[model samples]
Each structure stands twice: as structure tokens, then as C-alpha cells.
Target: MTNTRSRGAASRGGWIRQYHHPRGDAPTLVCFPHAGGSASAYFALSAALSEGAEALIVQYPGRQDRLDEPALKDLGELADGVVAALAPWTGRPLTLFGHSMGSVVAYEVARRLERGPGPGPAGLVVSGNMAPSVQRDQGVHLMNDEELMTWMSDLAGTPPAVLADKELLATIAPALRADFTALETYRHPEGSSVECPISGYVGDHDPHVPHDGFLRWAEHTKAEFTVQVFEGGHFYIEDQVQDVARSILRDLSAFVSRRLARHPLA
Candidate 1:
């Protein structure tokens, strides 16, 4: 699932991934990609949920058109920026879906939105990552260029062609390194938690994060918490993308329906 170029005003931005399906008056699904991933990573997800929701993919700095921009190395800072960027679209309810490093970003962003202003995310779907409160020393950012690439390959997120092409690898390494820095350095603030319901998804065989890690996400959310273990490794969504999408839409639709029932337009 890669990005296929589209032309439109919404598609042209350093922050928005243009491959979204704009559902008129539908609730929005905001997606954040994994470490070293671009918005295109969620292109398939966006298309899958197009009819039911407006899927918006976030484009983090140091990738694609944002390549020239300096990548933020702090998770909080990245979340802050995302909150501000999405301020204009707060009229409707939102659901956030993030994978791996993106899970951390989505968690933090949900925390901010819950405490600061506007409607909090209707729900949060965290995939391929442990709970933010679980502290682990991931020193991948500090590794040498060769070591970092090798580690990413082990995670199986990087394409073989991209790894084999020296020029391409060099071009993307800086962003990858910066992304790792953000993930490794993130620390959940003391007593911080989100009020929104949380759903955690993990691969049964994912070596990087186990079911225990995913289960711990329950502690960080004050609302309902559920975990779904799928079959595969770190990038399990590749095999169950539709299942993931359906689960997301089901949860989001239920929440939106309840919200509307309580506060229908006068």
C-alpha cells in the first residue's frame, strides 16, 4: 500500500496526506504512521474506510514533501504541532489510529486534546506498540547509520529495494534517525492519561512488543480498553488491513451515534 498521487487543495500540505477520502459531514479518522513511515503507509487504510469516514493521514516532517523541514525529536512537540494543525477540523468528532511509533504520537495527541480544547477523540486505536508508561531503552537513535538501517530491516518495515539502494537509503536515513530519537526519548508525564476509550492491536508473534505490553495500554485510558491479538509479526496490518479498518469504523460509528443521540441539533 503506497501513495498514488492525487490533485486537490487538501492534498497539498506538509501536514496532510492527500490520499484521503473526504466523506461529507462524516466523522474523521486521523492516522499517524510508524517510525520511518510516510503518510502513504495509511493509504490503503484511508481507502478502506472512505465511505464511512473521512480518513486523514498525517505527514510528519522529514519525509516526502516535508523532507526539507527539520524533524521534531520530541514526542510531545510533535503531538503539539499535530493538535494545532488539526484545530480547523474539530467541528466533527474524530477517531485516531496510529501504528508503532505512531501509537505513541496518537496517545500523546489524545491526551492533549482531552485536556486542552475541542471534542476529544471519539476513540483511539493503538497498533504495534506498547503502552507509553512502559519504559524501555530503545537506543536505536544512537546507533550508527549502518546499524540503524540493519535494525529497521529486522523490524521489517523498510523495503528491501530501499535498503539496497545506497542513494535512497542515504536520503531517508536522517528522518529515520530522528523518528527513532523521538520514540526512544518519549516519557509519559506523571499522572497523565486520556479520557477517551482505547483499543490496542498487536501481532501475536510480534517480537518487538508482546501481548503484555499491549494489554498495559488499559492503564493509560480512563475509559474502556480492549486488546485484539492478530496473527503475524510487527507489520501485521499488512495481512489484516480490512479487519483493522472494520473494527475502527465499527467503534467510531457507535461512539458518534451515541454522541448525536445525546446532543442532536436543535
Candidate 2:
């Protein structure tokens, strides 16, 4: 629910990274990042959470410090690695938050945790992505590396500093393409959708995922359901982080209050 002084790392060849604010009293909030993104994506998010929670963000490999790592081409491979890597943190009433490609990954993580030998997540937050059940992917992942980078450039908001260099873009292209493939081609395991409280966040103007795609999440979580629109694009989670952070904090607060009322943390 919360972070203190915790630390996190993933296999250099793996597809996830992590950060921990180590503290036992705070609830643990596990975050998954967008495609071509690392845990650093949520660094500012910690400040937005309630004081009673710590943030543990997942760093999808293939970018930032793990740039040398071979990025994962399969969404399941990434999700499996994520669930396995964070095995130690699955205890207690955990909350999972995912944005963009992260939203799907978080949903998958929730599914994995449900199937795992542990308590399911107390709350679920999905942002900037369409529901996994209904996809309109045109097989952009099948695009050659050059086209993939162009697609990512047109779609994602990877820092300009990184995108400006041809050599750097060359290095990052495969992973970006892989991320697109992972999102585009991934199929939810047969009949596995979570029944936890789910809140959906979307960019008011994101073209990649539309309202209809987000509505499909209703078939998944049986707990309380919600959907909110923001004022940006596919990456609205970043473009309007403060507003998004406030919304997230609000939901996290409600979850905490309800949880403490039902099962006080001693």
C-alpha cells in the first residue's frame, strides 16, 4: 500500500524493473508501467498517494538502466516475470495500478494473483488502456523496426532526448516494437477476469482506446466498477499526472478507509 525504503531489480534480460518505499505500516501499492517505459514513470506518483500507502512501481525492462536487457516480445512472458519477481510482496491487501500497456499488464497481474496461492489485490487501478477483451489492433507489432519506432513516436511520449538520436532510436526500436506486439497480440487466458474493485482511467482524447473498449472491463471485475475520462491522449496519465494522481489518491483513500474499517491493520 505504501513505500518506505524498499529496493527492487529485475533480470537484466527480463522485462520489468522495480522501486520500493520500504515500510510495513503503509499499505503497498504495486504499479506497472506503460510500454517502452520503466518504473521511473511513477516516481512522481508516490507523492500523490495517501500517506498510509507506499508505492512499489514496476520497471518494464528494455529502457533506462535496463536498456541493455532483451525486451520481452510476449505479454504473458512479461506478466509472468512480473508476478514471479514480486512473489515476496504478494502478501496482505495489495493494490495494483497500471497505465497504458501497464493497464493490461496490471489486469493480468491481478489475474495471476487471483490464481496464485495468496490473497487477491484489495483494489485495482487501470489507466490509459482499453479493456483486454476487445482489441482493434492492426498488427502494428508485425511492422519492421523502423516502422515500429515511427509508430511509437507517433503514439507514445518517450522523452525527446532519447528519440532525437538515430543510434539510440535504433537500439530502442526492437523493444518498442516488441511492446506494441505484446499489447496487440496478447489474448487473455481462457475465462480469467478479476472480480475485484476496478477503476478505469482514460484520456478524453486517446484515439488508441475508445469508450467502447473501456466498457468491456465491466465483464471482468465484479466488485464496484468506475470509469473516468481525463484531458489528454493515449498518454494522458503522464500529460495530466497531477489530475490523474489526485483521482488515483482519491480512489486509494476510499479503498484504504473501507479496508481499515473491515480489517484494521494492527
What does candidate 2 score in Cα RMSD to the true structure?
3.2
Cα lDDT tens digits for candidate 1, 1-266: 11223224246696766565654556778899998999988888888888787788889998888989988888888899888877666555678889999999999988888776576777888999999988756789999888989998998878899889989988888988899889898888878788778888888889999667778899998878987778889998877889888888887887677556654640
Query: lDDT per residue, candidate 2, 1-266, as tens digits?
Result: 32221343432334334333434566667788877777777766766553546676776667777777778888888888888877766666678889888888888888888888776677789987777887647878788866766777777677777667889888777767778888888887666678578989888888878788787877788678798888888887766767877787777777666656766751
How do the predictions measure up, each by TM-score?
0.92, 0.86
Deviation in Å, model 2, residue 38 alpha carbon: 1.6
What value does the lDDT take at residue 29 in candidate 1?
80
* Whole-model alpha-carbon lDDT for candidate 1: 0.82
**Candidate topping lDDT:** 1
Worst lDDT run of 10 residues, candidate 1, spans 1-10
User: Which whole-number lDDT from 0 to 100 does residue 48 have in model 1?
Assistant: 84
Q: Could you give me the TM-score of model 1 versus the true structure?
A: 0.92
Per-residue lDDT of 242 in model 1? 93
Could you tell me the lDDT of residue 213 within candidate 2?
A: 79
Prediction RMSDs, each to the true structure: 3.8, 3.2
